[model samples]
Target: MLVIELRLMQIIGLGTALMMPIIGNLSDQYGRKALLTLPMTLSIIPLAILACNRTTNYFYAYFAFKTLTDMVCQGSINCLALAYLADNISYRQRASAFGILAGVTSAAYVCGTLAARFLSTGLAFQVATFVSLFAVVYMRIFLEESIPADQGEGITQPILKEGEEDNIIQNDDNAPTKVPPFKKIPSLGYYLKARFHFNKNQFADLMLIGGIVATISQLFIMPLLVSPIGDGRLLSIGLFASCVYAILYSIAWSAWVPYAAAAVSTVMVFAPPSLRSIASRQAGPREQGKAQGCISGILSLANVMAPLIFSPLTSLFLSEGAPFHFPGFSIICIAITLMIAFIQSLMIGRAPSTSNAENSTEV
Candidate 1:
């Protein structure tokens, strides 16, 4: 299951890396709302399939369509949504708004998970499909387009004018997806169950607690830190905090220690929004979608490399015939990745930023 999951992650990563930049640039040229509608609509078909029936034939059908839709929808909507916000909000207020957006996302995740626990799997999919449909309708009716589809500068701008598209596509073209691993690898839960004796109920409890922390930090504390500290520095801080969180969990001698690491997430959770905010500051209002898409593309490509490198390492280290007895070895390796990211983030502070969005101290 774990190997299969990792392979799936690699595939999704590769597909998204190729697709995200195109989607992003198209959103810039067309409109965020219209582009967003595609993935949101594609996502519904698979869910609606599952909701209707779960027989073997239907399950296979669901699996095929789910794979197809997930590749398109993963990370794509969020990129467009952030770009849409960047278009409307003042750069000064953008970080705080991004934090709010992330908070709401975490909140939804928490709420949905909790809700699903009480409902049957069939009901959960039905509800999810319904909510997705409602969200699409709500977005179309209520949300104003920042850059109208018809009024975009032109499709040629990002290609012919900047010449940055090659760099965007060529470099960072292999990072991969983070979200699908759980669904793909049920063994992850089984592994935790073996190591920590983590039962379903206990896992749910941890999620509830972690969700509360994530929601509060993203909504309140993160917004506070961004305006005063700047996203660059905040990103560094968050990355460093994330290292501690990962290290703490990797070497956790007791079950409680993992929960303690979740507490550190109060600060660690700030990294992603901070990174996105910094990226947002770098580009002009007109180029928001392109910039965001490039970043997302890079991240998706990174996902591809992640599984290829880590899956075997994890499988070997976790197996009984391992060279070393450290169950936490793979996790420590992940911490090293965070540390590398941390080092890169520090350079952001050293470099001079031209945008007041990154340098401004006013709250």
Candidate 2:
């Protein structure tokens, strides 16, 4: 049962990796409400099926439906919500908001797991269906549309465009910027091509840095140092810890070595939210959705690639073939990746801090 569940999750993760950016981009155009509503409404069907039936056919049906819907639902809500916050909040406050949001999610996860201990399987799923339905209804009735149809072009603008110059073009009747042709449904090939146009090695290295940083800081230390060090510096600390964790894990001689190395990894939990906060601050008013989507896409890509990159090497070295008996060989490669990320994090830390005055004056 555990192995089946793990495989199911892995499949779902792959789906999420492919669909997240596309769905996020769609939400930017059609408004978050509609896109958000469709997924929530569809989610109930699979849960309700599981609640009522235990037959093999029903289980397979549930799995199929869930795999499809989970692709749409998993990260879409968070991406849209972060974009919504970007629309409303000042950049200075975004880091705290992101942190609080992450905290709320962690609390919800803990509560749900604890609650599951008390409820039967059917009851748990039924309760989830009901909660999902309630959330959909509440959002439909109460959540005002954050992105309107007319301003959709704003979202499609190049994220790295000069802020002041873009604003000038927006204000002037004579100097209109050329609008790229809008595709209501972007092709999978187009998305893959556009999303991954960067140097693969560099991208992989940077993601490893961010991933390790986020894993260690957010999971272990961010809760403690978030207020004191600030998000960017906390990210730097997390990256440094990740570098250390990688090195230790690589050279580890005993099983206990990996366990000890993990102790130093508690600082990475802050990386994700902190990075989101910084990216949100960088985007223009209407560009938040795009920026956040890009971030999510990068994360998903990393999730898809990490196992492929690490598993083979680990397997080869651990097998009975006659090579140097280094169990830590795979870990050394990981450590090197972490080092690249650490250097990037340091550069980010040393970059000029944006004053509230500058943010306010930005377009």
Strongest candidate by lDDT: 1
| Model 2 steric clash total | 14
What Cα-based lDDT does every candidate model obtain? 0.71, 0.58
State the lDDT of candidate 1 residue by residue for 187-301, as single tens digits. 3344456578899888787677777777888888877666456666677787898788668866878888866767876887777777777777666556788888888889888
lDDT over C-alpha atoms for residue 312 of model 2: 60
lDDT of 1: 0.71
> Best candidate, TM-score-wise?
1
The deviation in Å at residue 188 for candidate 1 is: 6.5
Across 134-177, the per-residue lDDT of candidate 2 in tens digits comes to 98889999998877333322222222233444342243211000
